[model samples]
Target: MTLTINTDVIRRLRDALLAEAATGAGAQDAHPHRDAALARVAPFAETMYLVMIADGRSAPQEIAAVRGAVRLLTRDLLEDADLDRLLDACAAAASERGAEVMLQVLGGRLCANRGDRETAFTLAAAVALADDEVTDSERALVGDVAEWYGVSSKRARELLGAMQSTG
Candidate 1:
C-alpha cells in the first residue's frame, strides 16, 4: 500500500500531543517563548530533507513529500523563497559536511524542547516512509534522529507504527 502523509496523519499526531499536554503528562511551560530556531520552518524542513535524501536519492516524489510536510508542520509559514533557500542549503550541506553532520548540528539546536524533539522525529519518519518503503539507510537515519532528539525507542516505534498503520 502506498503511504501518503496528508492532513489526517498530521491531525492525529497533533491531537495525541495536545491530549498529552492537556493531561499535564507532557506539559511544557504554559507561556514558553517561541525561539526563532524553534518557530521558523527552515530548520524543520532541513531535517526532513536530510531524511528524504537519506536513501541516497532525492526522487521528485520525496522532494514533493517533504515540501508538503513542511507546509503542514509550519502551518504554511514556509514561503516559496524559504523553500528555495532550504533546498539550496540542504544540497550545499549534504555535499559539504553530510547528513550526519547536519543532523548533529540540528539536534543540538532542537533538543532543548521535548515537544520539538518528538515533532522532528515524527516528521522525519513521515518523510522516510513517504514513498511506500523505507530503505535501509533511511531507516537507520530515522533511528539516529530518534536517538539524537532524545526520543525513547519505544516512542519512536509507536510513532512509526502509527504512520505505517495509517498508510
Candidate 2:
C-alpha cells in the first residue's frame, strides 16, 4: 500500500524527536526535567506509528523517510557530540535487543488507547515483512512484541498466517 504521511503528524513527530534528542544531550534542565521532556515525545512517536500501520500504507520508502527526517531533526536540535550520542544510543539499542524494545514502547501506547492487540501484533509483523522477507531477528522481535501483548503463540501464528494469506 502507498503510505501518504500526514505532514502535520510528521512535523509534530519530527519536532518531538528533536526535542527529546536535545533533552538527552544536556541541552535542557538537569534532573527530572529531561525525562519529563522526553516523556512528552514518547506518545506522539508511538501513536504516529500506530496510525501509519493501521492505515496499511507503511512502505519501506516511507519508513526510511520518517527515520531520515527524525535523524535530521535530531542532528539539527542537538550539538554534534549530543547527536553522536543519540545515534550511538539508537544503534546500541537496535543491536542489543533488535527492534522489539521500540515496538514495545509503541505497543504500550496502543494498549492504553484500548486498541486491538491482535491487529497491533499483526501490524508489527507486517512492518517486519515490509522488506518482503521476515528476517530471523525481525521474527524474533515480533514474537517478543506478541508476547508483551499477552497474545498466545498459536494466536499470533494464526494472525500472521491470515495476514500473509490476504496479502
Candidate 3:
C-alpha cells in the first residue's frame, strides 16, 4: 500500500498555523503605540522575510540583515523577541504554502505610503544581497514584491544597485 499526502490538507494546516500565530495566546501587544508601530512594519518585515527564504534556504547573513533592517525600520518600537517571533511566523507561513501565496497575502496590505514602499524595497534588496549573491529566485521575488506594492521596476533595480554599491 502507498500513501500520498494531500496538498489541500497541507495548505489548511499552514493557514491554521498562520492564523494562530497572528492571534494566538502568546501574540499580545505590550503597548498600544508600540503595537501600532509593529502593525505598520509587520507587512514590510514579512515581505522581506519571504524574499530571504525564497531560495529554499535561510542563511545566517540573510537573517541577520533582515533583522537589522527590520529593527531600523521599526525604530525599537517592537521588542527583539517580538520581531523574531514575527519573522519566524512569516517563515513558517511562506515555507508551508509558497512564495506566491505569501506575497499575495502581504501584497494586499503592505507599504501603502511611498516611504514604506521604498523601505520595503530596501529591506528586500538588503536581504537578497546579504550573502554577496542574489539567486534567480531572490531576484524574481524582489521584482514580484515591487510589482505587488505598485513600485516601478526601474526604482526596484535602482534600490538594489544602491545597496550593492554601499556594500
Shift in Å, residue 43, candidate 2: 6.4
Worst lDDT window (10 residues) for model 3? 1-10
Report the C-alpha lDDT of model 3 over 1-167, residue by residue, as the tens digit.
01111123323332333343333333244655777777777787788788778788888777766666555655545666787788878877876978788777777676467777766766676667666667778777877888777777566545444322111
**Candidate with the greatest lDDT versus the true structure:** 1
| Segments of candidate 1 deviating more than 4 angstroms | 1-39, 162-167
lDDT of 2 by residue, 1-167 (tens): 11222223333443443344344433342333444433433332332243234333455532433243333433334234433344345445545653556667656765554345655555455444443444454455556666666566666655554322211
Give the poorly placed runs of model 2, Cα more than 4 Å off: 1-114, 162-167
Model 1 TM-score, all chains together: 0.71
Residue-level error in angstroms, candidate 2, position 155? 1.8
Give the 10-residue window scoring lowest on summed lDDT in candidate 2: 1-10
* Per-candidate clashes, comma-separated: 0, 0, 0
Give the distance in Å from residue 83's predicted Cα in candidate 2 to where it truly belongs: 19
Candidate 2: lDDT of 72?
Answer: 41
Which residue pairs show collisions in model 3?
none
Error of 1 at 86 (Å): 1.3
